[model samples]
Target chain A: MFNKDNQLEKFKDAETIIGASIKVKGNFQGQGSIIIEGSLEGSLKTDANLFIGDRAKVTANIESKDAIVNGEVRGNIKSKNYLAIGGTAKIFGDIQYGEISVAKGAIINGQLMMLSEEHKRNDKLKPEEKAVATDK
Target chain B: MHVYIYDDYLNKSKYNKTINRIEIRLTDLGLNGKIIRLGGIKNIKGTIQNEIKLGAKTIVAVGNNQTINKIIGAVIDTDIYSDFQKKTILGIIPVGGDNSIAASFGIKNEEEACNILLARRVEKIDLGIVGQYYFLNQATIQSLGTILEIDDYSLEIIKRGEVSIINLLSDKNQSIKSNPHDGKLDIYIKTKRKDQTYLSAKKLLITNPNNKLLVDGVIEMATPIEVGISKDRVNVIVGKDRMFE
Candidate 1:
């Protein structure tokens, strides 16, 4: 049997599921990680990592160091380090990151812009994280 | 051995009263005890983090899902991994914030949770991680996401409420629509013209060969979208009757 205490710590590197019945409206900020298996209408700010699950529906903007999407994301997503959209991903917003890899079958309606050389320099050098948005 | 009490009772008087009662209970039981009342929701994370950092063992929580979520987030966020051996048990009182995770775990009620805590037998359960946070309940994205937008505090107030998975499928606007021809984003569509109840119901169960894919939470008009899960990664705590994946 697992210890009821330290259960959270044991899963320091576990995959998460945000089920379909959950809708969160607040700014969700976390560090270690999470997988959105449900719906989110607010902002997702995480410095650790994120996995947008296949069944997830996110209307909120996302900020992460790394992300993998096999789900549907309607808002903008900004990753400082890495980002990937699975073939099943249906992304409707802009994506800004240092490195991005999209699989062949992904559907993205939003614009895609690689980080500018100066922006990359500024991003890496900046002490705190920065937000990226496509206003147009 | 110090027993730390983490409760969400914001009212100072009530909070103090509850802690005093617990302290009396502990003293009667002949255990070294100290009652630390967790304040309002916002202060919860910081308090738990501080307690764990100070090498406090045995966290006795006194609230529901919202409180648990905050504590879990802080525990992971602060990266207090080194204190696991000392902070080895979680005692919960199923109060406030709907207590969904508590109910699901069969903690029964606040009294039962307290009893279990006093008994102090450790159990392991499944824990879900999203990015860095740890979650005990299942995560959803699309159809269920819509439901989450409804009233939270009110919905939580209900001891029990169930959403029909069947109802979600029967609703045409929410179900599969059409399978677009694209390899990148796999789409599956299921729709039917309104007909007699029996006929429409039967058709609903049948998969639509062509339906647009709702990837994650967005509609996938393209061919195939990717998806996967690491089933082996989740770890959590549960009673002996619990079944883990």
Candidate 2:
């Protein structure tokens, strides 16, 4: 049982948390983890992990280091590392990830693209990014 | 040298005992200095500027949040007179209501405030600025249908929430500890559902006209005002019990 609020304790050091009451509609770019529980449109790009809560309704193309989705999304998601799709997740766009875990009841309405290991993105990454991706 | 600027409200007799005790403690600690009552002053910023010119090293505000906020605005405003030898240090003694700023600095009461001042643990802190006023803690506004523009992005708060711009975090329950030494401001947005967000930026603009910016929980100014931190820093006297280092 992934209790939404309780799970937040794990990311207590999160750099940003877009609460359920907020509706963002532009390019939100940053350098740390971001948790979204609200309604968002446009694009989200982060150099770290992203956590989408169960109540969230997002319509943005997302890019992150790692990702966990539990709500509804209508845009493409790109996770450089592992992508964990929870049972209650409802996504409507293509996905790109290195490795992924899909739970029962997860409804995805688009193609799933597994990044090729030959790309060797990890080896090409800057030292700082490799460290962050490993830590996650 | 220490120069205490007493707020006008403290003139009431109810605070006599606290004031007397504070004076005795300050004298005993060899920290007693000139006391100027705000009741007799008209232009606060000018008076403070004159004190800095006269080599007043420490300026202590004796009152609640309003007192501290005024002093911060005044003290920080005096930074242009930097030809002086030392940066004037700002201190506070919480004597009345709305003393959150002082409490964040670990100055709970007038007596404890005196001892904290004696410790003289000075910190260089950032100031949140809106219009001509400055705040040492945080600035807040209602997030009901508010639109904010930061850099190239814009945020529209749909549901009722709170938008806070933090320089120095006073809420111990908050997950992120705000470092006042950092030049950026921490923007915390929380909805009624307890979901929250934290963003750090140098400056942001409120695109909505219906919003009012509440600085340090004391002063309220009209909306659509640009909010950011002052380029200059202030030296503050804090205590060990302070919420943030």
Q: What is the lDDT of residue A63 in candidate 1?
A: 88
Candidate 2, residues B56-113: lDDT per residue as tens digits? Answer: 8888999987887666656554564463225678889888788888878877788888
TM-score of every model? Answer: 0.38, 0.88
Model 2, C-alpha of A91: deviation from truth (Å): 2.4
Model 1 lDDT per residue over B1-245, tens place: 45455654534465566545655655666644555665544566666667777766676556666656655556653467446433545656665446656655556565456556666655443343323334454332222112221212101011122222121111223322211111111112111221100100101111112333232122233212212222222122333322221
True contacts kept of 1: 0.00
* Count of clashing residue pairs in every prediction: 73, 1
Model 2 lDDT per residue over A78-103, tens place: 88777889999999999998778899
Lowest lDDT 10-mer window, candidate 1 chain A? Answer: A1-10
User: CA lDDT of each candidate?
Assistant: 0.49, 0.82
Give the residue spans of candidate 1 off by over 4 A.
A1-136, B10-23, B40-46, B85-87, B141-245
